[model samples]
Target: MSRTTFTLDDLKRILLEGSGVPEGADLRADILDTDFTDIGYDSLALLETASRVEREYGIELDETVLGDATTPRAFVDAVGAHLSAQPV
Candidate 1:
């Protein structure tokens, strides 16, 4: 089933599975506002994560929007917005 909202937990799981967590990066910590770059997630990693999220959720996420989402919170919010716009 498709999801209606994207949460931080989802991001963490996807990040781990899609790109593998970087060394010394603590995903379990409070990283909502932490910049993706700070945690070793670069544009390529974020793109991969976005691709995985799109495939899993059956929603298309704009690359530009994803690029704008520098933090996990913003990424989740961007995915949530796309999910909400999808047909029920």
Candidate 2:
């Protein structure tokens, strides 16, 4: 399988949908308003979201990038970087 390019909006949509947030939710606001330690996402939820992203973009995310993702913005940014670095 080959990776498809994704824009920031595309990545946000994937993340929002995977995270069970409404399509119209303000991603920036959502991230900014959350407390990472108490964000309520279980390990399974994070794994699910990460797997969804990997499936959607056809890329296996690096563990280093995954480890740094402590917030929604971090997730978005890391996924965006992966998308950008993927083969054309």
Residue pairs whose backbone atoms clash in candidate 1: none
- Model 2 poorest ten-residue lDDT run: 30-39
Model 2, CA-based lDDT: 0.64
- Tens digits of per-residue lDDT for model 2, 65-88: 556777666776787788788767
Q: Candidate 1's error at 6, in angstroms?
A: 1.4
Model 2 regions lying over 4 Å from their true place:
1-29, 32-35
Residue pairs whose backbone atoms clash in candidate 2: none
TM-score of candidate 1 versus the correct structure, residues matched by position: 0.93
Query: In candidate 1, what residue range of length 10 has the lowest lDDT sum?
Result: 59-68
lDDT (Cα, tens digit) per residue for candidate 1, span 44-84? 89888988998989998886877689999999999998998
Highest lDDT model number: 1
